[model samples]
Target: MKRWTHPQDFIALIVGVYALLSPLWTTTTSKATTTMVVLGALTAVLSVIELVRPDTLSIEGLTALMGVLFFISPWVMGFSDMRAMSWTAWAAGVITFVIGAADLRVTRSHRGTVATTL
Candidate 1:
């Protein structure tokens, strides 16, 4: 019924889409838009991997990294002046990070259900 799969990954995917398209709703400088698009693309790509393969936690881990990057993009990209971009990055990044952490927790609790790599 598609009800028992990893919901965390699904949430990540949704968040990724939103982040990727965030530039459309907000008016920002070129740098901010570029940062948003790049970060969002990374999050989405990692999410797709998590869904199709569900391999080791590495994909989820990468997703988390992407989230972190997004959250800090405002500062790193030097576009903190744009409130919309900054806020969007923060929100999207936090959501993706939370999802990744939740997935990790779910897998850990599954009792060997999720495989790991060395």
Candidate 2:
């Protein structure tokens, strides 16, 4: 769990990059491409912000929401016809969700000590 601290934001960042580039390697529709790139970019930006300000747990939740969006995007964006793209979306979504949740948990765990210090 020690390695699963705020620095763990790196997971989301990497996942974000993977999602963003997936369209390049896989066959995806315009809608799916847009969805992946937007959400991935947001995840990367938020993770960087979280790294700078450890107290920004909300960013973790936002990233998690982005993950959820990624998971549902194939259906929502009407790109399910591309099986490869859909699989990539689902897999990336799950990985991104896990990373964000882990980061949130780590941040919350440190909150008690931080409260006392304040």
Candidate 3:
């Protein structure tokens, strides 16, 4: 069992699980479901990369942006009236984005300790 030691990984793991399950419970389908699943997988991948490397600004930024997109997908797509599930998904997205951003900031601030020079 790979123990998650980073916030990004924790968030990503949560997002990934949600994505893998949303299609079955959210009562949503097609494009929306597909997009959520894709974003979830992306988050998980980026989180793993951050765990291994933890110094790539580009990946962190991209992950955060993707998180934001997921958060607002329901609203922007006019699906706000969906249900608690949508709200929870959006909330998870926002939290994931924040975690990614915070990881970047922490890495930048503690570059000497966290980010290794290659």
Candidate 4:
């Protein structure tokens, strides 16, 4: 069996794909699409890194969390209209952030086990 569970892998894979494609479906005006695409790309890249190297997956959650927060900043801070991009951005951000937090928690909990075995 693999170190990471199937559901974890699937979720990560799906999220990574979504992040990569978000920019294509959304508007690109005023750098909005550019920013979203960049963030999504980052998430996808990091996820790939995690999949290939479980030992280095420690920061996946952090990356995801940061990406989501960055995506929602415009509306979260009252700088942009909530209906235009805020809701979608916020939804993406929250999901990514949760995934990141979960990954961080799982990675942290497993660290002790690995250490004790060493």
Candidate 5:
């Protein structure tokens, strides 16, 4: 396995785990709980995949998509009134989105150089 190449992936992994376990400490509705668990797991999995295969640019895009989903989930799932949960979702979402998007940009820009050198 490739040694984790990107710091963003590590940060994403942390955010994912936090989101996954947040429901235990934070008051959350069933919908919020489910959303957190699902999105968190997906984030974690994608992060791991990226860490193992840093060249997979598509994974970064998916990670960004996950972040957007997380950001909007509180409202779409009707749990925005829960301050703790909503805030968690929004913060994690933004962090994940930014990391993913940034990584995607860096990876894409570097791709041509890598190909030309090979």
Candidate 6:
């Protein structure tokens, strides 16, 4: 088993799980539930892959993309009127995006440093 190396990935995993479970507690239409489940699963799976292989830079981009999808899901999926669900998506999406972007920056900088030193 791969060791847990990144706290950001762990947080993202939590966010994914939350998103997956949110539809149960929140008022959701069929479309909203489907969107949440699919996006949440994608986020969770990507986070796990990142946790296992932190060097996989592409995963960060994918995660950020998931965040963007999540953020816009309320409007696109027609759930924007549901204040609680909308807020949840907005908050979770922002959090996921920041984590992915920040991690991507750090990882790239580290790579640059290594390349310079080598």
- Highest TM-score: give the candidate number: 5
Superposed model 3: Cα runs more than 4 Å off: 1-4, 112-118
Model 2 scores a C-alpha lDDT of 0.80
lDDT over C-alpha atoms for residue 49 of model 4: 66
Q: What are the runs in model 2 whose C-alpha is more than 4 Å off?
A: 1-5
Superposed model 6: Cα runs more than 4 Å off: 1-3
Q: Could you tally the backbone clashes for each prediction?
A: 0, 0, 0, 1, 0, 0
What ranking emerges by lDDT with the best candidate at the front? Answer: 5, 6, 2, 1, 3, 4
On lDDT, the candidate that comes out on top is 5
Query: For residues 4-115, could you state the per-residue lDDT of candidate 5 as single tens digits?
Result: 8689999999999999999999999899999999999999999999999887659989999999999999999999999999999999999999998998888887887878
Model 4 bad stretches (over 4 Å): 1-6, 76-79, 82-84
| RMSD from true fold, candidate 5 | 1.5
lDDT of 4 at 85: 49
Model 6 Cα lDDT, one tens digit per residue, 47-94: 999998887758888888889999999999999998988998898899
Candidate 6 pairs with clashing backbones:
none
lDDT of 4 by residue, 8-118 (tens): 534655665675566666643555655556666666666666666667745666656755665666654553653544545666677777777777777777887888989
* Angstrom error at residue 105, model 4: 0.9
Query: In terms of TM-score, how similar is model 3 to the real structure?
Result: 0.76
Candidate 4 has a TM-score of 0.74
The alpha-carbon deviation from the true structure for residue 55 of candidate 2, after best TM-score superposition, in angstroms, is 2.2
